[model samples]
Target: MITEFGLSELWEPETRRDPHAFYARVRAAGRPVPQVDPAGNRFWVVARHADVLEGLRHPEIGHQLPGLSHGEGEAERIASRQLISLDPPDHTRLRGLVGRAFTARMTARLEPWIAEVADRLVARARELGSFDGVADLADPLPVNVIAQLVGVPEDDRAMFRAWSATIVSASDWDGSATLAFAAYLDDLAALRRRAPADDLLSELVALEAGGDALDRDELVAMIQLLLIAGQETTVDVIVNGIRLLLTHPEQWRNLRDDPSLADAVVEETLRFRGPVEIVPPRFAFRDLDLAGGVIPAHERVALSLWGANRDPEVFADPDVFDVHRSDVRRHIAFGHGIHFCLGASLGRLEARIMFDRVARELGTLRLAADQGDFRLHHGGLPLTL
Candidate 1:
């Protein structure tokens, strides 16, 4: 019977500024809170740690209801094929094809190069004496790493970064940036067909040519997911991790003294403030019971990862940012179940390397001034070294 608040409250400037306060109330309600989105679509928010975990793995819940038409627009058609938007056996098939490129071992192979990239970025920031964390270090490192891994040419990476920023930040698709990105990938695929390279895009292009493995739209969708999901969320993790450490001076000193604590810092940051407040919306295929409430058939269900990560029952003193927390691994910031983030290993590696290098090279750092609350896409995070 949680009826007082809904999605409108969740989207308010005040709530976005301090979401955990809203989430705390939702979790206390002891059930899935029903909500109506701005579009007037009915949905439910699953907030508790146990409930969110179960919702992610539930058999009756998915991206789309069973036996429903995919949709009938260019954007909808393309979006339906994305890794994040599909259910099994399509999800299983696509993840299998792309998973080879992002395996833990493959990610490990890139660590030395990733560390080199992090070192260069940190060294340049140190030389400058004052730098914006987002623009100088957090942004470029992942863009370069993921671009190279995806076979996007170094010369065109600036354009790629701009397109990503545009598309992700837009409230509505409008399809302008997406169309341009698809066209660029189309050209890149043509090039890879003529001259294969040692990268993921070239591999996908080969699969598409083989006839049975992939289609043109699926190929573009895969690359789009890899490029955007690969970099955007990781940027948040890195920048927010830095923001947390500087704000928590004692934690910053802890990492400064022991650079190896970078991995712990990444974990704690994900728990404290994950990049994704809610995972992309899921749907209830039939009337379903979860978290002591029932969601009607075909209704949208939003799983709040931020809420679950801070559940006090799961993480002791969950509000406090602690790099030494024993249960930090339980946080599902990258998600759980079948739709888990394909780039988790790579994201972790990149963040760990960047934090370690910042600790070793930057020495001591402080925020230049008050920059208000940290945002996913922000102007900058000015820091004085």
Candidate 2:
């Protein structure tokens, strides 16, 4: 039998095209499965919805693998403090600080601007007759929105994009890209301090919550997280959602007829083809029981968001892409517990507006290439449309 990791199959480009069927097999097993990584590290995969939830909230599981990076450099140490890589206390404090900067009110305020961006992209697509949704609309939308939030100048978005792409590269193992990114953030931080602006990064710089403020290294990590995460996964969501809708014509027609269903479509798209295939690896801090098995201390645990979202026990007709899926909201596409995505509201807002504008402004969207031709970024979602 294929290991659950094989089901995820990060390496085989063809397998990345559709890992759902493999995830379905894991779900059919109805329990956690152990697997190995390319680095020869062993890990457990929690595939069932209930098990994934249990593991996510398990106190003994944490983001760090002391076994893996016990002697790593300072850059790696600072990265461990990032929101995604932290557990409680620190995670709680940092989450509150960053969350305040991205309140629903602030996201609501961004609607008009986000809508304008979508409109402009759709208008360009109209001009070209047929365009790859990735380049024309999906990729640039979130990048520009995040750039605006970070106070990056309009003249510098391209340069910022290059810096972000390099820093986010899957091959950046030596931490050189990380050091370069930190250097850029250092310069940007000095500039922001000298002349602050009405932007998210400025708010982050001045952010003080629970009597604690982010230090310079923490600030760099936070900005790095926001830039790559704020833009990349969001871009995947938009591109994947569009690819799903275009391929599933009936669902697309259903959404087009009832634009109110755009919200539902977005939810369903997330469940069916969420941007992140699996949650970041969590280490078992101590021996712990999980879904009919024991995970030894210091072992790694990987949660399959893809598997949980489509578990047959939870969702009816789990494989079908239904726009009006009633149980769609139950999907942990944005994740669960305290570590849920802080930028979810912004992602949803961007997606809803883009879908609406496409319905109104875009003439017709056709997939420019075969689904297999679309490249998956380091086991993340497809990036071509």
- Number of the top lDDT candidate: 1
How would you encode candidate 2's per-residue C-alpha lDDT over 1-385 as one tens digit per residue?
4434563354466545666766666666555677777787788777888989988888888885555663467568657768898877788888888787767777777788988899899888888776667778788899999888778889978877876787666666777777877787788777877778888777777654334678877787787788888888888778777778878888778777777777887788789878777888888999888876788899888888988998888999989999877888899988888888888888887888888777666535656556643333332332222
lDDT of 1: 0.87
By how many angstroms RMSD does model 1 differ from the true structure? 1.8
Residue-level lDDT of model 1, residues 251-315, one tens digit each, is 99999999999999999998998999899988999889998889888989999999999999999
Off by over 4 Å in 2: 1-17, 65-74, 208-211, 373-385
Instruction: Please list all clashing residue pairs in model 1, or write none if there are none.
Output: none
Compared with the true structure, all predictions reach lDDT values of 0.87, 0.77
Worst 10 residues of 2 by lDDT: 376-385
TM-score for every candidate vs. truth?
0.95, 0.91
